[model samples]
Target chain A: MKEVTVGIDIGGTNTKFGIVDDAGTVLYQSKLPTQKHADFKDYIQELDSAIKHGLEQTSSDLQITGIGVGAPNANFYRGTIEHAPNLVWKGIIPIVDIMQKDFNVPVIITNDANAAAMGEMIYGNAKSMKDFIVITLGTGLGSGIVANGELIYGFDGFAAELGHVTVNPNGRNCGCGKVGCLETYVSATGIKRTVYKLLADHIEESELRGISFHDLSTKMITESAERGDSVAKAAFEYTGKILGSKLADSVAHTNPEAIFIFGGLSLAGDLIFAPTRKHLEANLMPIYKNKVKVLPSGLQNQSAPILGASSLVVDHLNKKSSVNI
Target chain B: MKEVTVGIDIGGTNTKFGIVDDAGTVLYQSKLPTQKHADFKDYIQELDSAIKHGLEQTSSDLQITGIGVGAPNANFYRGTIEHAPNLVWKGIIPIVDIMQKDFNVPVIITNDANAAAMGEMIYGNAKSMKDFIVITLGTGLGSGIVANGELIYGFDGFAAELGHVTVNPNGRNCGCGKVGCLETYVSATGIKRTVYKLLADHIEESELRGISFHDLSTKMITESAERGDSVAKAAFEYTGKILGSKLADSVAHTNPEAIFIFGGLSLAGDLIFAPTRKHLEANLMPIYKNKVKVLPSGLQNQSAPILGASSLVVDHLNKKSSVNI
Candidate 1:
């Protein structure tokens, strides 16, 4: 029988799942609106049927080895998802325990960023690297730190909250009840905020002048910057400066061989990477200069979340049997 | 036969060596001025003879097992001391290679902070902890990070340089050619700088008014604070605030169970600890608040350096033999 794993990615709007083979290939996939059910139990019940229907559509010889989940505010040690603000669920949810009971297989869970790091190690650019960091630059910045070939769960399993690290002390208010968090200035939303501030501060903008704050998006800013828009360009520059300087502080913490930029803002390519690399080099300690690389994620964009979640199963099975993949 | 190891602590002024048994006992100890010989070879020759003489004074049944050295800028991967400003050695000195050849036993070398971390794991308060941080507060600040029960040597074997992390982008100039490094405002010299700034900023009847910069010392400042000197007290409060806030950033990085303060400044007790703890809690993310303990080093002050260096040998031997001691 061919062995496969069920990979699940839980998001605020939709929940995506797939049957993945050992080679990181998604055999069958489906999605459901996350908030369609008011109760978490009802959501899980619908998810179970959806997954079973997906399995039936796939080739018949496949046997699911385990289930792996990626979600927000996931506690790996407790196998639960704690009060994640973006989620409709109000309290702690024992996702792994409930999934294991239904699937009758080992269930594992971690935050999406950590799962992404594992995917990078198993199938992306960090294959040969034991020490590296992956930064997810979506609506908010998230990070996964891999040192000595293992993810750092810390004492309470909530480690690597890089976005929440204080940047300006009193600069900007964050949703996490903190001020001047790195995410407030570096994520996609952060880039938009910077553009709005630039437009308000300068009158010489060729584009992005009349764009409403709610209507503005990072793609529009990226396109405008590509067309020589001064405000848009300055926004990316300012965002990179903050990210690069803070990355220097992180380099001091773990001294990773490379830092991979993943997710939405990363798609801006040289606009984000160039400034970040330039500032990272400029801000680094003399010994760390010209050594660490800042690179883009190697995983295919469309399948990244599913691939990341699936790789966790392979990693878990290998560890249990003392085998290296 | 009683197996013992030689532990060496190479300081700027002196080099201390001790013959230590398995149970962390010092059988014999001695010291020599580090700058007594100009050439690195001559210094090694003198150290070799000194160690032999000290070994002869110990019990006849003791068998030499290994050697461990702790010094500033020591590299574990390269087994060399690289461009240490405090040491007489100018460039990279292959101390481990030279010593291993001389003694015909396995030799290990790492920075003093990392050695202290190993000592804490083996014989100090972190014995039960797999994840913790040790910050040494002496003439300069140094740090050692432990995660997943292993020291983070990083990709270049120079991880955990927490002292050089920028506190302010435009603040005080650091000896490392950076501005506003944490150590520039938190070490013994850092405290002295703060006290001088306070003296210049305020016009109070103070005992520190007539003292020149060269005549000032952290010990004197501690005494003045105890005697209710406002300048001295403010200095401590300022130092603690910076240290505490930066520590919150570190907690976000590794999520350690505890942070141990070591060396000269830590000897001040509540003068430093109270402010540091207060600010650390005030600045920590809501999830990490009150979860991390900021405690003093559990190792005895006098023997800490020696014991720290000695523990490296025991740790190395255990790793080689696949034993957990």
Candidate 2:
């Protein structure tokens, strides 16, 4: 029988699950509204049923190898999601434990960004690269560090919290109770906040000045930027400036070959990339200047998350098989 | 025959060479004035003679296994020293190749901090730890990062330039042409600058205000602090604050089990440790709060550099023998 692995990407609003082949092809796919089920057990039941349906839709001769999950605050070592603020369910969620009891297959879980890094290494631009970093700009900034051809889990299994690293000592208050976190100034939400701050600072003629913070979206700002709104342009420039400077600092740690930017903000293309690249080089140490590349995700946006989550299972299977050999 | 490795620590002023055993013992030691030789070939010849003399001091039954040399800007991959500003040699020096040709044994070269890290792993407190950081606060702040029991060399051989990481963008100008590098505020030279700045900022009478920047030393500051000098104490506190805060950022990259401080500045004991530890805990992320350790090097001040440099040979021998088996 052909081998297939189950990949799941859990988000605040919805959870995407798919049956994927060894070649990273999604044979079957499904989604569930995460907030619909208040109880953890009910959510597990719905998730299991959806997985079973996906398996049924796929080829009957396919043998299930393992399952891999990517979640907001997931811990690979403990297989638990701990106090993730955006999630519907509160407190530690033993996801791998629940999934394993239901599916009776090998299960692994990690923070979504780490899964993205694994995806980049196994199936994306970093296939041949040993040292690299993957930064995801979504609701908040997330990072995954790969060094010496291995993912750095660190001592706590929660390394690569680049989003929380302070950029300005007194910059902004974060939900993690830190001041000047990179996420506070670099994420999609961060850009919108920047737009309002720019609007207040400069008396520039801009269409975005009237929009409320809740009403403002990254799409609206991107559209405004496309139309050459000064505030929107400044916001992107400011975001990139902060991000690029911090990226230079991260370089001092691992000295990655390239930094791959994935997720929503990355879709802005050169608007974000231009300023980030300029500032990254401007801030780098003389020896590292022009040595590193800032690139976009090679995988399609719709498939990148799923692909990253699936690569986890593929990585596990490869390691397991190698051990047996 | 007894197996031994030659470990050499090459500095701008003096070069320390020693014969060491697998147990991290320095059997025989000698020093050579580095800057006295104007030409690279002259320096090499002098270094070769020093190594030969040290080897002669040992018994004839001793078997030469390998040689490890630690320098200011050594690269393991190229086995060359790059543009190290402090070194007498201006450009790349093929020290490893020259040493190999002379010694006819397995030779390895790495930056002093990397050797210090290897020393910590092989002979010091990190013997059992897989992930830790070694920060040497000597003339400048040098760092060696160990993750998963291996040094992270990145894409280039030049990773772990922690001193160059920006601590305060507007703070101080560094020799690397960067402003606000951590080394600008925390190294032996850094603390001296801090002492001068504090003397200017505060009206509190201190004896150190009379000392010139050229004559000021970390030892004098430590003694002054021991004698209840408020300015010296403030300098230590200020240095710790900047270092601890930046270290908090580094922790986000690799959640190290412990951070070992070695070199001249670390000799201040509680004067440096008390503030660094307090500020480290204060600035840590909530999850990492009080989980990581701030420790002093277990190796003696005189022996640590030599042992760390010697560990290169031990590491090389270990790897070579393992490959054969």
Every model's DockQ, to 2 decimals? 0.81, 0.81
Q: For this target, which candidate reaches the highest TM-score against the unseen true structure? A: 1
> What digit string (tens of lDDT, one per residue) describes model 1 on residues A32-90?
99988879999999999999988889977878999889999999999999999888888
Q: Which ten residues in a row have the lowest lDDT in candidate 2 chain A?
A: A316-325
The candidate that wins on DockQ is: 2
**RMSD (Å) of each candidate, 1 decimal:** 1.9, 2.0
List, residue by residue over A43-107, the lDDT tens digit for candidate 2: 98999999988887887788888888999888898999898888878999998999998888899
lDDT for each residue of candidate 2 in B237-275, tens digit (9 for 90 to 100): 888888888899889999999999998899888888888
Which runs in model 1 stand beyond 4 Å of their true positions? A323-325, B323-325
- In terms of docking quality, model 2 is high
Q: What is model 1's DockQ versus the real complex?
A: 0.81
lDDT of 1 by residue, B155-230 (tens): 9998999999989999998988888999999999999999989988889877988899889998999999999999
Q: Model 2: residues >4 Å from true position, as ranges? A: A88-90, A101-104, A320-325, B317-325
Candidate 2 scores a chain A TM-score of 0.96
